[model samples]
Target chain A: MNHLASQLVLVPVILPLLGAGLCLAFGRSARAQRIISIVTLSIVVVAAGALLWRADQFGPQAVNVGGWPAELGISLVADRLSALLLVVSTVVTLSVLLYSFGQGIVEFGRDTPLSVFHPTFLVLSAGVSAAFLSADLFNLFVGFEILLAASYVLITLGGTEARVRAGTIYVIVSLISSVLFLISIAAVYAATGTVNLAALPERIAALPEPLQLVLQLMLLLTFSIKAAVFPLSAWLPDSYPTAPAPVTAVFAGLLTKVGIYAIIRVQTTVFPDQPLRTLLLCAAILTMVVGILGAVAQSDIKRLLSFTLVSHIGYMLFGIALATEAGYAGAIFYVVHHITVQTALFLVAGLIEYRTGTTQLDRLGGLARAAPVLAVLFFVPAMNLAGIPPFSGFLGKLALIQAGTESGDWLAYSGVGAGLAVSLLTLYAVAKAWNRAFWQPRDEHVDDDVPSTGALHPGQNTVTEDKVLRLPRGMALPTLALVAFSVALTVAAGPLIGVSQRAADELVERTPYIDAVLGDVP
Target chain B: MSVDLALIIAIGVLVACGTTLVLERSLTRILVGFVLLGNGVNLFFIVASGPPGAAPIVGASDERMADPLPQAMALTAIVITLGVTAFGLALAYRTWQLEGHDDVQDDVEDALVIRRAERDDTSASFDEVDESLPEEEGADLPAVDDEVTRENDEDHESPDDGDPR
Candidate 1:
């Protein structure tokens, strides 16, 4: 039993999913369900941290399930990069659960919605871990499906008219992306004999350049949709706002980054010599421009934040497009920092909605006056998101711009400018939302009751608790924990940058990955 | 392409059906369209993968081993599509029950006041509505346009009483 210590790596991916099933089975008691979920997630979080430390020691270990050879069966590989995403995802999800404890599950599933929320959330945490750890293409696909299936339930849980409609769009877009991804996998398989990502570069190299480009392009299409890049991003802004606040925060924090992660993985590991560099730069520019344009027009806080989510993806992609060492490091740093800052800001938005009964600027007011503690919570993340200095977002944006400028390519240079412009635009949009919801005076009488506009929607009930939802200690502490970590990321940007560089260098170099899989065995 | 022609044509028909359904006024039809679209894409995948070069079975003869990977990828994709389709159908049904119609145009009736926009014929109506509506108090501040969009407001106050409220 002690000999199988390495196999424990799979537990973080398995336990919470099993926990989800247990919650569903024991659905009668909310207290029991909540306890089961929290305890299970806490254990998973510990496992993830241990796994990160283990990966650090082992330097990208691969574990084959059922003791099959790596080439023949699924392999759960944990490198430093995967460990980073795994740790970040588990921490964010567990925190969201704590946040929802007091806020209450107000989003989907009417008959025992909390019962559904816990189980599905646990399953989602498991899915994210699996996707992060997977070294086999087939296992990656399974992980992607797990995450997608869980998300569908969360997205439509409330069954509100707004939620349902938004969910419809989300499902359709996701389905198409899934199909495209499948087609690409099929094409890659027909061209190459195997599906192990470990063996890809050698196999992909033997193939013609055109075929390589095709496979790379297919992957780009699939991941771009997930990342919500440019033309592929229409679904996110509308869909995200309609879900419950905590669910929205998790989705914003983690889901799109999975796409960015895939792009990084595929580009660096699978097809290093491909012609995607220019195309990526073009997409980055358009994604920033179009996403910011949408944000500029929004008066609703959630909607504006969703657009900013799309725009920031452009910054991440810009780092990828550069295809240089510094560039990849910058992209990885951006991913971690963005995940923390984005989720905290969203939590702040959720807090405002709880207090004011609406997130629209016109209806919401005096929140700075109404909930000063919550106001500061919202303020820190908002500035961070806008890439203000001394915060993690600023450090990431600076690294990315520096990488782009070092390349000195005209299109890449303009992409840097466009990224900065988009940041300014994001700042303006978020600031406008802040001024309206927090700074401006609100309609006190209307807010006293249900804040009914009765024009644009069938009211989806937001849990308006009378106890003054000022972060409710447990929730606020976790949110602030993530926010403080974001500050730490900025403070220790040098070491963080070093870690990303190590991961990026190994990936672009590709020799270690191939040798690890194909065996320098015999 | 020596792929199954029938399957290819069926995929095409489904694509057309889906495109049309998604364009319709009712959300139910649109969900049906999405289902058709997803199935169509799956069919297209089958065509692209060279009709499953062999069984998904792994066995003795190396040359005859059908590539199990694409089939595996397809299987996962199909499962995801099924979950999404089910969720979408559930949402449409729930919306229909709540609002009494699945018309996406009227998806939000009372809540999302900020995003509602009236695309009324021309500026003739825009001018009339803007002129007739009183300015919000605090005119000196920046106009962030949190006003309820006129289209949704008009839909709520439909002229005909027979329409579903």
Candidate 2:
């Protein structure tokens, strides 16, 4: 019952906001902005770690902002689930900020005026943290708005035609989803007379079955589009790959995962009965099959990775679709693993783009000979993404498949089948990229736009040849650090999965979360 | 009841028009459609208040006061919509300035991907369309051409030199 421990939930959100404001105040000073952002994010990461530990020890913690009562004012709650996601996301963001520091220094001189990146990135961090910490539905929508606004700026950073075009499609899709979400919120409020998530379950359950189904379906559709589950995911591959590398990395890694997190939160809490489990299973199957099919068809590495990102979300949906404790546990584990692995892979992709001037599979070759460190960076995460054995990805997939088998339903079985197929195809896609980009001899027929002739012939031992493409230490170091973090997940799988199981238990039981916010309400 | 009915009908019309406009290829139309959709949702929120009555201000009399929560939510939604709409306009303007048209190009490869996915044919000729399309020179090249072109444009027009837009 330590007061400070109880109030620790707000630190993740407020620190980013304060940092964003400070960066804005220090406008046009790139050096100051970088120091403030990195320092602030590091502290936020520490705060999130403490919050997660406290939540684990004390069975979820809540604090009412401004001392207002729950259901009347905004409240921030840190259950094991939110705390876990907050820590992982801040770690990813902090690394990306460092990666961007490396990128900005290389693109503009050290004294240039690229001040917009810091504040906008901090705001995006705050919004994401707020979304995780929010205990109310309306506040979640506001969180989405803040993040989407920041992302719109980040995506179109240079205002080039391609970036602008991609930014427009992304904004329109996101705005449509936000509107649908707003309408659903209105519908929920009209039916339940409140938006407090903790107070939602009993009230939502009290509604007529058909109305409940409609309301649940509306919310599902909104989250589905945001999560980029099949049929609704057409915008993602086209939208994400066009941004600057770090921007694309964060967007691919974190944004859709936020949607998945919300789905797990709402599905397990507000609609714990899971009336639409069968439909969810169907969406999971299609998301896997269609997404991977698209991935295998892609020639461009970024688009290929983007497609895999969409496909892997189906695995998480499979866990959620099961609605069992093991299912929740597997989904949570996959989320953490996917966030780090996907971000690391994208950072590697960025490095490849830095070296080769393109992510087109046809143009890249002999990177293994040219930059062995970069090849290892790509190969490890790519294998992890494909769920190779002894890696965290395989463990997470095994957990999910086991959960599906325990369910013993045909749909669950099919979902597990689709999961396996997707994993194999994922391996195929990554291997194809690896062979084409790293193994094959450099494509000498590549267009004149590529100026680097430093790529060596495969099997040639001239390792000390003059390398034309010099990787910035700032960029390469952060990429390697992220790769190390992904490796750490594999090494730490046992305790990590244990934490996920505890989180799943909290998610399934629902009482810890409810009581945290409502304080012993029957 | 009548007021709620009218509000509901207005929402339906706005949503219908908005969805239609959003489907168009033009960016400006999509922006307008977003505004209309926002308005429709805002009105729906107001209608959800149910039998609007006196202001929610605390007083001696106002037993049937409007819920006020939806109104507050609607006001916040309006501000958000305004900000997004302004940003959308700025993006549209920039797209127009750069590309000389505001039409949102349908993703060329998505349709191709879907077509390939449907046939489930051999993977050998899958990317035939992409390969056959005479690889546009510098297609995957980053920002260099655009930057150089922009610098030239700025040099020609001193009036627009200062604006980052």
Candidate 3:
């Protein structure tokens, strides 16, 4: 059973890669590619669930490739944090994949081959899984590179002028961060003699205080850029809104969160003593205030959501800065909640764009009357994102605010105040969007090019003489599924929070992870 | 650990030049800068591996052997840099094809903000109530002229003729 659990650690990372290979091989047949991706991801979801259960039941599970010792070769570890995030992220990825298929069939005819999309998407999934499971710093860097390479392809998939422009900024920023990360790794190895996560704590602790702070700051700087923390976040709203909706959805949901995950891992395990608490707290407050201000100023729904995405990251940063078990637990729970809600909101925005051919808020109106279903879909997640009671967002924020106030530091108290104000501001922003895009009467100046509403099934050809564009059932169902999943997170908050608390405890203790990786060596 | 002064100087020069090049608006220059920066970092990995010594393979050396790990890491970094360079060049080519040059343009929204501030206007999207008012009333009411003037000014300045959807 132990061996089996250990082997399961590799499945999430490997299966998507194999699926990507098959997807590329079967590129000419869209159906085959779709089937391969769906089946592979389904298996990954199940495997991740099993891994989570095993991790919760036992402890961290580790697998050393080629039977190499932990220090000598790559090791993949699935502790409670990793496995839980794996399950959530894979589920989100699968839903977005399905949503994109709906979009593809609608935009291009059903028979058109999406050869590049499927393969690149699967590779992206593989990279994300690899990053989550990797147990060493170098392996983590490789994981980031893999995902980033895939993202560059995905972001610029269409090669449109706007896409190419946005992709340039995204690519350049990411490359700079990667270079910085590589330099950090080289510096770390120069100082520590090892890059393995389990071995790093001891070595890093032995370094002089100034040296340790420098290394910590360097890593934090690299990750802050990736995570879209405040001063470094201007590129995100500018770039993310230009991608195709599904790409934007997944990137908004998962990519920055991966950076946050890395921050959690390194801060907790690699540097157990928190030295930069005040710095992180300031960043958290600034990110929240500045991000929401940007969100409130946006006229485009996609751009507004992107800014809000940046804002909500502050909440997670707030939790992490607290540096307590409760704080980590809240952050983990918030990560799960935010991923689902944010992705669902973006998917709904896609639907809005699909129906109206635009996301500009001023030109959009009466969606509640014209497409009541979309209104409901947008409403639920928007309210959830705003921390409305009875939703997962509120619960996650409650957990974070509770953790923050419990810390008793003035900075934390100020963070709690900023968090509360941001929640209200988020509510205002989304409410303004809701009123502009849905509740208000249809504007007479809205584009005449918008197609008349007609609901259509997946396989039907949407092209017609009158140019009626229908809401594809394929797209709506997957989005609905995601919204339902967010609600499920709220309904099942008790068990989920328990799991997160356990994960947070293990993260803070740090021994279970170190032992799982290197305990059996001698 | 013995460090090579020459290698350190080379790394410093490469990184400094790379940083300057990266700050340029031209995509081609930025790509070149990226490559130099990447190579500089890769050399740092080599320096981190310690003083030069024998090959780290069985039966290849009797003396102190060089660490193989940083070399492997450098190789991986080189491969990644190679991939990124290809992609960057392709992007630059695409930008040139599209716009007749590969220099990155200013963000459209930033330009819009500067335009708004020059006319002493707030965000166009913020005041929906003013927008909802009847056009004649918006024009006739002296109190609402500022809003109306701002809206008209935006319409004239906007490339899409007041609709950039």
Candidate 4:
């Protein structure tokens, strides 16, 4: 049983890969693909949960593929940190997958040529899992590549002019980042003859200061681009808003967080004593300020949510920059919180888009009266994102702020201030969206976007457009499930925070991870 | 480990050319730039593999055998780059098919959105000081609504006709 538990880490990555292949084999059978994808993802969620339990109980576990030595062969590790992320991310992906299935039914009926969506999406899940579990730099890069390739397909699903345009920019930016990451890997291997992350700290520490700085800065720059940190983040808002709603939802929620996860992994593992601490802190401040400011100025809900996504990345970076156990704990907890909240918000945005034929704030009005359920859905996540008390977002932010103040550094202190401002601005932005889109009185002019009253579904109370807005059970159920999952995170914060703090401690110590992999190598 | 000056210089030249080409507005140029960049990085990876020597196979003389790991890594990088370039060019071809231009066009609304954000920010700052601004300063407000309505109009015209391909 212990042996099996140790090997559970591979299931999360492998299950998805197998599911993707099987989904592809199902070919054009959207029903079959949906069943295969959902079942596979559900099993993956279970697998990830088991791994999280095992890691939390058994300490960090390592498995070298094909019985090869750890340093020589690829390794998959299930530490507390990776395990926690794997669980949350898979859960989110499952919800989004279900949402997309709902979308498929609505858009193309039973047989959508976009059958390609299922296989590509499963592959993306595999990639994300691979990234989280990978214990080496090269493997991590491979993980990123796999997910990115899948994302390229997902983002350009319909190949519309706008999607193609956005996809072009996204692909170019991703390719550039990939190249930079390759260069960084080569340099690291050149400096220290191995890319095994566990073996890196000693070798990297032995390198001269200037050389170490170069490698660190290079990796940081690559990840900063991937993570959309401040100045490097301009490409995000433009690119993400154009994808189909479910695609946009998942991309907005999980993709950037993967970059954030990488940052935490590299910073905690390879460069535990951060050399660019001050720089990271400054970037956090600017990212928060700039992202929220952009969010506030946006009139489109999708674009507004994108900016908020960028802004909230600052909080995670805050915990990372502090480089303390408390900070890491806060960061981990915040990551789990943000993933759920962000995914739920985007799902709600997708709902809004489906119902209204647009997500523009001006065209949508009195939705609170019309679709009370959606209003509650949007209101929950929006307020949660705004850090309203009793919500997980608030708890997460409070943890980060506590850690920031405990750091006693001026940079961290300033980051706390910026974080507070970002929270307030996020609230104002969401409130403005809510007021305009949901609370404002319906206007006949704005009703132009809807179909003529004749097309209204029977019993749809369309006072102005004379049309009823039907919320699909398929879509709404998954979204409501996610919203409940987030609320559960808040309800279970005490235990979750404990788990996060323990995970943070293990990450901070680093000894358990190294020992688990290298086995007390001198 | 003696440095390979020639390889280093070639890599530098490749990177320079790639950078310049990538900066151009033409999608084909950008594609070429990306290809060059990939090649340059691959070459750098080879350089990072260190001085050339005997094959890394067992039973070969172990005297300064060439490191095979970086070579393996570079090969993977090359495969990935090939995949990316193929996808990018396909996109470029598709763009040409649709819009009849290989040149990337700036999103028409991009500038307008940015300008509005800036205008709103300035007006917001003014309001912070004045605390009582007339409706004239609300000009940016309506402009944003106009953009939304225009976007809504476009969205309504072909509600289901995305990606005719």
Point to the candidate with the largest DockQ. 3
* Candidate 3 docking class: acceptable
Q: Residues A218-260, candidate 4, lDDT per residue (tens digit)?
A: 9989988888999899889888987888888888878888899
lDDT of 2 by residue, A1-522 (tens): 567766678888888899999999988787898889999999999999999998888788788888888878878888999999998999999999899888886653542347888999999999899888888889989988888899998988888666787888999999999999999999898888889899999999898999999999998999899899988988899899878889999988889988998899888889999888999999988998888987887867888999999999899999999999999999999999999999989988988887777776766778998889889989999999999988889999999999999999899999999999999999999998998889877744533222121232233222333344678889989888988988898899988899999999999999989888877311
Which pairs clash in the backbone of model 1? A108-A157, A108-A158, A109-A157, A457-B108, A457-B109, A457-B110, A457-B111, A458-B109, A458-B110
* Top-scoring candidate (lDDT): 3
C-alpha TM-scores of all predictions? 0.84, 0.89, 0.91, 0.90
**What DockQ does each listed candidate score?**
0.17, 0.22, 0.27, 0.22
After superposing candidate 3 on the true structure, give the runs of residues whose Cα lies further than 4 Å from its correct spot: A108-113, A444-469, B128-165
Tens digits of per-residue lDDT for model 1, B17-132:
88788777686787778778777767765665665454656675455555455555666667766776777677777877877877765324213323233422211101112333
Which of 2 and 3 is the better model by TM-score?
3
List the candidate numbers ranked by lDDT, top first: 3, 2, 4, 1
In the range A1-522, model 1's lDDT, one tens digit per residue, is 644557667877888978988899999888888898889989888877877777666666567777777788777777767877777788888888888775773422343367778889898888888888777766777788788888888888767656777877776677667666765666666677677897877899898888788888888899899999989997898788878888899999999999898888878788786477888899999998988877776657787789899999999999999999888888998998888888887887877776656776656666787788878888888899999998888988999999999999899899889988988987888777777667766654322122233233445434344335544575667677777777877888887777777877767787665555555221
* Docking verdict class for candidate 1: incorrect
Collision count for each candidate, in order = 9, 0, 0, 2
Which residue pairs come into collision in candidate 4? A460-A468, A462-A467
Estimate, for each residue in A1-522, the C-alpha lDDT of model 3 and write its tens digit: 766756998898888899999988877887898899999999999999999999999898788888898788878899999999999999999999999988987753442237888888888998899999988988999999989999998888778777798899999999999999999999999999889999999999999999999999999998899899999998898888878889999999999999999999999989989989999999999999999988887767998999999999999999999999999999999999999999999999999988886777765777887888999999999999999989999999999999998999899999999999999999999998998889776544533222212111222223222233457898999999999999999999999999999999999999999988776632
- The models' CA-based lDDT, in order, is 0.76, 0.85, 0.88, 0.85
Best-matching candidate per TM-score: 3
lDDT (10s digit) by residue, model 2, range B36-88: 99999998888777787888988946477888899999999999999989999
lDDT of 2: 0.85
iRMS of candidate 3, Å: 5.9
Q: Which stretches of candidate 1 lie above 4 Å from their native place?
A: A1-4, A105-112, A443-471, A520-522, B1-80, B106-165
